[model samples]
Target: MAAIQALQALAIDVMLPALGNISHDLGVTNPNHRQLAIGVFLICSGLGSLFPGSIADRFGRRPVVLTCLTIYVALSLGCSLVSDFTALLVMRGLMGLFVSGLMVMPMAIIRDRFSGDRMAKVQSLVTMTFMVVPMFAPTVGQGVMLVAGWRWIFAVMAMLASALLLWVWLRLPETLDPDNRQPIMPRVIVGNMAQVIRCRASTGYLLGAAVMQGVLFGWLNSSQQLLGEHFGAGEMFPLIFGGIALVMAGMNFINASIVERLGARRVSQTAVIVYILIAVAHLISLMRGEGLWVFVPFITASMCLVTFIGSNFASIALQPFSRTAGAASSIMAFSRLLIGALLGTVIGQVYDGTAIPLFIAMAIGGSLTLALVLYSEKGVLFRRLNPPPLKVKAG
Candidate 1:
């Protein structure tokens, strides 16, 4: 899960600085159109999660992930050579479609091995490990752009995918048992997904993470513009973004330490409340026309709050449906990525002169997340340690 999640994080941050150059070179007139190149990949990743799991169950997780990584590499290199915007978008979408195995299989592997609170603890630890990559990817991407040019962003991604493929091919063991392996029947996968969705608590975290992911994804799609154009910090964008990412990493580390004791629900609920408060404050500051000095601090704080929500919510959701982890993970990831892609599109559309659009979207997403959590838990803000396993309902 850690390695795969790291790959997912790298997908966005590593190409960020290069986006400007690509837009100029590709003859993209609107800034929003440039954002679509990134958005399409995310949307496809969401859509891609629907397959591959049942395939993994049939063919084996190691083989499926390896094949996907190889395809991701080929498509990423294809992205580098594309001459037109449509071609680049198509290649990116293809890259996303293939990378779904990486996104969903790690959790399945862990589920194949672990259960209960042990799974949550391991998930938190895995999340912290992967958090390090995004923390530095922008910096790495910026360095690559400085030395190798914008095309080299894809080059680096291809190289990383190559390396990961080699490692997975060699090191990963097949976790799916032959007796339990499900055929790649679309009806069976969709039927399993429906069962996962009907479990109220599990669906709550899926929606909660969806809303939160939308906020983060919107910020990611717009952060470069928000910092460079709005705040007059073009040169400082990577540095500032990286610094906030590190703060988020620190918060994830803290979550790893506390989640086992405080439990996932308590920590996540507190984080949501804090996230909303900080987002509102940031929106107000932007409304007042203050610059980085105002926007940077609150944005950083909101990111800190985000750390509390992300992994713990996944841990809680995954806890109840251990038997169905593969299917459940696929559903949860699909919802999260789809919401992110849609919200990101809306945020990209509203890119006015300042960061207000971004901030407003973040605030709204965070508020919705809070409401979803409350409603899901029947107004209970915290979970009892060893809370009852989520009730799986007949679809």
Candidate 2:
């Protein structure tokens, strides 16, 4: 799971330093178009999730994941070999298509094995591992870019994918029982997705996840240019990125430790409000033309809160659907990536060598998230305050 998340993080962060190189090489005049390359990958990856739940239902998680890993490897190689930027972009989109399964299958496997508070604990553990990679990815990508050519980034990715393929082939087991497996027919696929969407508990958590992911995705779309180009922090980019990531990593650990005790709903609800406050403060500061140091710490805090919110919300949203793990994961993952990709593209386009747009989007996304959480839980924001535990009465 960590490897898959790391792979996803590397897809964007590894390309940061290479943006200029790619722009120059591809003869692209607009730097924002470079952002499109990243955005396209996420869009494809999100759309790709629509099919895999049903496929997993039919073929089982092991084969689907293995197939995805193989595709990720080949596409990574394709990315390395592409001569033009357009070809590389196309290859990246293809890579996302394959990697969508990586995001889905792992969660399905976890759900296959755990439930309720136990499942929530397991989800937090997996998310912590997933969080660790993004924390260091930018730094690692920068280190590689300094010593190797941009193309070598893809080469490293290909190698990593190949190694992971070996790991999967050796250790990953088929968790889906034949009796429980659903057919992969189109009607069944659409119906499964519809069922997930219609479940209010699921929908609320999914929307919360989407909003949290959107804030992060919007920041990612802006960060390379925002930090490296706008603030002239080119050399310090990795350290700054990693520092904020460290804050988020610490928060993830905190969530993992406290979530089962406090409950996922309470933790996530509180975090969303905290995210909103931090984002609003940052947005105000940017409007007032704050310094890089000022903006950096505030934004970092907001991101940390977002990380906390995302993990817990996912746990809460997914708690009710262990029986349909593959389909549930597919729905949530699909929603997050779709919402994130759309917002990322929008935020990337509005970049003006300023931090205002990024913060504005963050604030809006945070507000939207808190609203959804409130609606989902009958106008309650934090489960800690009221502690209205959801009852699963015996039939």
Clashing pairs in 1: none
- Off-target runs (Cα >4 Å) in candidate 1 are 177-179, 385-395
Q: Each model's TM-score, in the order given?
A: 0.94, 0.94
- Candidate 2 TM-score, C-alpha based: 0.94
Q: How would you encode candidate 2's per-residue C-alpha lDDT over 55-132 as one tens digit per residue?
A: 887789999888888888888888878888789888988888877988888778877776655566677677777767
Candidate 1, 68-129: lDDT as tens digits: 88888888789889998889999988888878778788888887776655566677678778
For candidate 1, report its TM-score: 0.94
Question: How far does residue 97 in candidate 1 sit from its true spot (Å)?
Answer: 1.3
Give the Cα error of residue 72 in candidate 1, in Å: 1.1
lDDT of 1 at 99: 87
